[model samples]
Target: MATLILAQKATSLAYGPLVYAHYLQDHESDLTVTVEWQDVPEITVGGDKTNVVLRIGDIQVVGAANAVHELAIMSGHASQYTDVADQLPHWLDFTRNELASGDFKQLGQTFETLNRHLTLRSFLAGYTPTEADFAVWGALRANKIFGGNMKSGGAKLGPHLVRWFTYLNGLPCVAEALKGHQRAVESTRNRVDQGNFDIPLKDGALGKVVTRFPPEPSGYLHIGHAKAALLNQYFAQKYDGQLILRFDDTNPSKEKMEFEQSIVEDLRLLGVAADRTTHTSDYFDQLYQYALQLIEDGLAYVDDTDNATMREERGAGIASRRRDETVAENQRRFEEMTRGTDYGLTCCLRAKMSVDNPNKAMRDPVVYRCNVKDPHHIHGYKWKVYPTYDFACPVVDSLEGVTHALRTNEYRDRNPQYEWFFDALKIRPVHIWDFSRLNFVYTLLSKRKLQQLVDEGLVNGWDDPRFPTVRGIRRRGLTIEALKQYILMQGASQNILLLEWDKLWALNKKVIDPVAPRHTAITEQNLCVVNVLDCPALPEARDVPKHKKNPAVGIKKLYTSNTLCLEAEDAAELAVDEEITLMDWGNMIVKRVQRDPATNIVTQVDLALHLDGDVKKTKKKLTWLSMLTPAEEPGLVQCMLVDYDHLLTKKKLEEGDQWQDYVNPVTEFKTRALGDSNLHDLRQGDIIQLERRGYYICDRPSTTESPMVYLIRVPDGKAKSTAAKVNAPPNA
Candidate 1:
């Protein structure tokens, strides 16, 4: 067990003696910690209350809680400073007092009170890692000797707290004893966070890569987006190439500033910071100039055709009335476009391409449309015309010094137009690589479809866990490593294939399995009760390797009571008197089963835990929570489990399908769990696997203290589980 040493001067002040606690843990080969103490108090020996209080006041400078929980733990008292802290002090005080009095149940209630509604890395302070934050983490662990917010309180702060603890523990000489422990880890496949990979290409082949993830700021990122971001980041990093992140903010009607901010954050969370972030709006001037150049060269013209006329012209290869205008007149009309007079639905600049081309995208595509009323996100409406992507992308690529234009095959027919724009403008050429866009079997990756879901309120906003945006994926707990692996594994190939969602989930599991801490929880459901019947008093279990291969992550399990809850499903499968292995705990036999008839829910499960001789029996295996486990016995716990499905039901979504009709009714499920108090320390972006369930991310914390609602990545497509060992992508 790690030892904590406290140095203090005793006093009878209203808040008790001022004390400073220092946590000490050896930097053994198996553990590591580094702590930096800022502004340590100079030597001050004071027996009087006033003198000690002044010293404590100085300590506060180094220790303002970074967030609510952290602030409360350090200085919250019942009478005087209650208002300065959050509202949960009564519960926390009660729990702390009870734990002091050896009342385990009340202690659990206290943790629940303080833990409820806390957010992960949700900083109340200006920056992170404040003294209050560390103090609260330490207090929670200390207060945890009583029990935690698992049952009586519906919160589970253990995993998040533990993760936070681990991170802080690595902060450069954290705990004096744990200074060098993390440095001795077995593997350090650290990846580049910036730059593009410089891959050598053969003649006539694209050599340098210039990949861009053009996200329209319509909504927050989703999980699928994380995959794309990481993929682009990985290729750029591996080949020493440039990765450009462009905001495809063509449709300003739905885009928002919040989404723009979130996109930056999502990329940061994925660990691949873009080298250069460009906006589609940035090229408006050049795009307009190119359009004018096109008109002068007889390569484009003004199209006054209304929507219906333009539609028919595009459909039947019918030339619009203005297509026959003289080149000088067309150029004059284009100049009029820049003057912002002919605005809105009536006027547009169309490429003067063949009306009878085999490829429809080549038939007089509208290069610029007038938007007079729309206010630009960055630049307020200074001009009226906006460039279409087909025209703007290649133009911007040339101007931005982009080398290879990588896009999905959906733009295959538009490549010629891309080339045309480059040639007509007399700009340097850009190579194009058309790979098949990612298509998940049960999910939609279409930006248009996703936008509809956001607009129609079919799900919670853009970052809704069901969405495939990168922010959504990070919120769903999918790791950057997993996403990078999955994306690159697709290998910049042109072949189109529908990837199974299970593969995505499986990859996530592998990436998370190694480093995520192990925790345990039993839900409110009866079958998942925690009752320790045969375990020895004060049992000791190794803090399981957070990642079996990475020694830097180590989490000790928390155990309590004599009874634990099992999942209702697992309870149903257990036959009375049948034997099963209890995960890492060997084997056990079902002694009895109880159910609530009205709810048809399992009320309780009684198991005769097998010890010693019968541990090797192979009849079956099970995962059980032990009530006999003490506060120090770390274990895993059940939490709110959420599962997501695609919003659209059909394979190829119809233009007008009601997105709400296809909404998966069952998107989230709640279950009580038992895991280590360590979970409470997890940071906002940490990714880990919850045993039996898929991988999850520590999303923003919820009420009830435990970072509620771990973003889960359940299988989306049906793939039969196989015994075949799957090989992870390289560096995953």
Candidate 2:
């Protein structure tokens, strides 16, 4: 390998050769040339500013007049360094030029496109440093340094690329380069770190608020956890307080590195990257000291009673024999327990709270447990003892300077205990914010249940669309904006409620409908044959918007023919001479209706133009497809027109009732359909509202060329009140 050395300032100029080499290699050209180092210009511009010159190696090159000042070395046979100022470079330069010119509109779009392709975690060459990574990083920082209207454009540059960008940006190395770039920093801020924290200053002065998102990495985070993360994050950002992401991985048995990593990823995905991401394990020594201080202060003790006996003793409002153990004995046993020498035979650490407290969690809960097994995930058999999450959480929060502690209402009872730990340890007080947990119907968010489903193959995995996992929802075409908006709508409330699926799906639709592309399909209808009056072979119709608002979203132009087909139901009641409106076109007349004699069902329909000049009045205009010019061949879609009467048949099921008996037989209906060519191009996970057919997502792509499988639903169909329909205004 030879070297092409350029000065540090000329690094940008070196980009051309490397890219050209790669491009040539891609084309299977093995042409090799050695580039030796020499003095070069700091910045090189477009060709035509230099003169012919030859160097010591007889390399044919041109030297520009006054180019020495500009570092332009040219060759007589000099080929323009076309590679340097090409498409990718032009985009980069356009971004830079736009930033300089203050044309933010164009700059924002270009940067958004670049951001989609570049990310921090991405490896430069191949998961490691490469010239491309560094170059892209430099250009991206310009947007950050010189402010612009920054927002994610819902542009996805593939998962590997996404993960790469995320990882690179999160690295401690590039953090310095990202300084002064508020948008970039905010993008990386952790969700749970937002909170109102008040630190106490000197002379009885109150300081600003700080908060932390402390997640126990024993299971995957659900929407409830996501809500807490976002609330804390919002508060932190609002208050300008430090947000910390701490892993309360105290119990090693259930916790794993996998969960820890996923918790970090989940937080990042939710736009929650705290000011600092620290772990409880990182402060084990301090936590241990705190525990010892509580024991020494006579505020905690070692309980040697077995689990069943201890529960019985606490429930009876009686202190166990171990509770009465002297401080010296308790301290000795705690040490022994920590060593795992007398673990099972010895005692566990418990905060000495009231036995008669109504809340079971307050009744001297155990703060530490001993286990001789290998470390579960991170520690990996390194320690024989672990602190409980409840015990470690407050300690770490205070130690990390966290001001506000936020969690779901489920922990309301334990809030006092959290306070007790701080009081007993003589630590600073942290404010607590309680909010309701989110519950979605038809899905279980319990980790154990989800794990069972995964283990038993009831669902695919964590990312299974059938499951309510974050990745699952994302894969199902739900956007981060939608998730944030939905959670915000739920608001922070003390009142706990079981959220209806209808409301959640409605919110989801609201976000996705405005921008998702529109394609046409119908259930129970195999083809749409549009009848035209000597229709042109190729009719050019502009793409129709999925949404009337939002012009940035793209649409498709559907072609029509003389024998366009409409849904069976749409054709069912059509009478001769009746007028029906075509969606994109004007009115058409129902010339005739054909029915199958054996089945006695509407089999087909014939139609003629119900031109506005002739038709005076009409009702129920419907959509149709032209059979003469089918963009996509017939029968390419397997449509499921899903209908759910209720999640449960009965209004409510008794505790012991056979609820499974109420499973709605007609919960879903599947049929075949002829879709446009554009519909055939829909990838799995694309959500589309079939015209008058309801909203749906493509669950699986078609194995054959023609038809795809679609899972769809009609909003508010089952829930719509008949009374409301009867009383509705005429137009509606």
Candidate 3:
């Protein structure tokens, strides 16, 4: 067995070799590796100041980068890809010289170069990972500058770079290595108290507590479902227990395999992994037998009550006429229903828990219903009758060994009904824990309503930014870290408060603000031209940091010339001979202003350079872009900026109110703008700030076929203007 020795306190520099070794152990069955931690100051076997040492038989390697190279060669990974093997030393040299030298300008340039290189490739070299990838990834991971930029939601990193980094980090080998190191460090610290807000489960024990996230495969998961899934995973992991992902596919009319697969993918995106997976249909036979057992015990009966009358009777606390039916007759009716006979189509199996209980949910709820129309997505047309959620949940929960049933408080009234199943069937009882349902103002959590919106073309699709679905918000720039942080901050509060979207978005802002690269854009409509009286005769290109606060984000080129363009609104606000500061340049005095006599819109302005003027004394610090000559056309990239409003005009839609009536007539607003030439290089899903125009995410990049680049405005947690202001043409 090969042994790898690492420092007791391993730094990020040690992650590369550790991950590589773990990967080899997982993938190569014949290879056995053991890892040991030592309290040595440093390993100097190869004259390198590293804490990582790898020994194989009589040969030893020192330093993380060196160990990775040696291991790749020894493991035969290098010889397989001889083309990429030569590039390993180049990346190693770059890591040692450029990355380790602490040169911000060179670091920024290197990040941009690497980002462009990864645009079309999965790894640094070839199709599979190589020593080049391991060395570069390790050095970047250990570098504080790269780590900080990534920590801020990768707002500073290019989209392709972020994607590549995320893919590597998500690998099981890499994740496990990092997590093991984190656990080792955390083990030395005192356990922090959760304070008074911690909700404890009855009879909960370490490794014994089992929680399940049961999502019906009727529609894509919304934010509400995300909360439930996360909370269940939280409790299960908190107690070192297991989490089971159970698909409650009881309603054949609505459930589909597509929805089931999407739910699974969404859960994975949310970092909620289940130890086991199951479906309610898995217990169909068992649940049917249990229902028959209840019938034999006189605890359930078959009812032929019409849907309307049954609902009215339940609301009025009235009993069904067949409540006194005999067990034999009920059994025969249930069998007929299972066979999908004519009379059976009208009948349903109802638990005899109660008929006139104050809690309506306990009023002999229907346990089994006939669904002869639509076949089950998975089971097919095997049976015409299917179990309802109320009946299948408790039965499956108990059968699956779920210790604590964590659900929303909306199901509190049904808690008693759920408990009655155990007593009626004489099965083991499971604890019921109810937390508050996540409710957002102006947001519809109902799958039916959201589906209606999609079907009616009220929005783009389920992933529309205006919609509150998990994919929707994510497309709108909500980071998984921000979403998880917000959900955890809410904790186990039972108070069902209607939350505003601002708070959640505010948290997202904090995650993206530090690293989001800054760019410039000016509205094309009513654009004002500015001619400098005394400026450079030729355009000069200067390199500047993309983010003023975060130099590690990289650099962008600024082209300066005598001609500049500003937003019409800014020009309209300026007066002749008034001194104003040009952002990123210097203060300038407005010498002349020209406007259209018809509409009083600023058309053109002339400014004289005032480099010695005090920029702080100017009231307006304006963002301006230099314009190219006639040969370069406009010298700016045309972009379309898209902003959205709430789908529903009303803050809270009440029961009995028509939601369609309150749909906002116009929810999307688009503005035409001219942006810096660098915007043309941006790919889809890149997040950037448009100087004075707030933040935007690239929905579509500019192409030769379509000259306009599409950008969607990202909402900050500030008070927004009304519909008029949002829809109005951009002046500011």
Task: Name the candidate that leads on lDDT.
Answer: 3
Residues 647-681 of candidate 1: C-alpha lDDT, one tens digit per residue: 54544446697655655544444444544455655
Q: Which stretches of candidate 2 lie over 4 Å from their true place?
A: 1-207, 341-347, 439-445, 449-459, 464-468, 475-477, 501-504, 524-551, 611-616, 627-672, 683-685, 698-732
Tell how far residue 362 is off in model 3, in angstroms.
1.0
The true-structure Cα RMSD of candidate 3 reads: 19.9
All-Cα superposition RMSD per candidate: 25.5, 23.2, 19.9
Is candidate 1 or 2 superior in TM-score?
2
List candidate 3 stretches off by more than 4 Å.
1-197, 629-635, 721-732
Clashes of 3: 0
In angstroms, the error of model 2 at 195 is: 16
lDDT by residue for model 2 over 25-50, one digit each (tens)? 33323333333333433423245322
* lDDT tens readout by residue for model 3, 1-732: 678887755454477788888887777676776777665556566466668888999888777778888777677667878977676788777765776656777788888978998999999888888777777787788778888899878777798888888888888998888776677555432121121236888999999999999999998888888988989998999899999999999999999999999999999999999999999999999999998998999989999999999999999989999998999999999999999999999999999988788999999999999988898999899989898899899999999999999999999999999999988888889999888888987678889999999999999898898888888888887888888877877777777888888878887889888989999999888999999989976887778999999999899878888999999999999999899999988999999999999999989999999989998889999999998633454368998988888888788888899998888777788888999988888888788988988888898898889978999888878778223232444322
lDDT for model 2, please.
Answer: 0.59
- Backbone atom clashes (below 3 Å) for every candidate: 110, 53, 0
Q: What TM-score against the true fold does each predicted structure earn?
A: 0.60, 0.62, 0.71
Of 2 and 3, which scores higher on TM-score? Answer: 3
Against the true structure, candidate 1 reaches a TM-score of 0.60
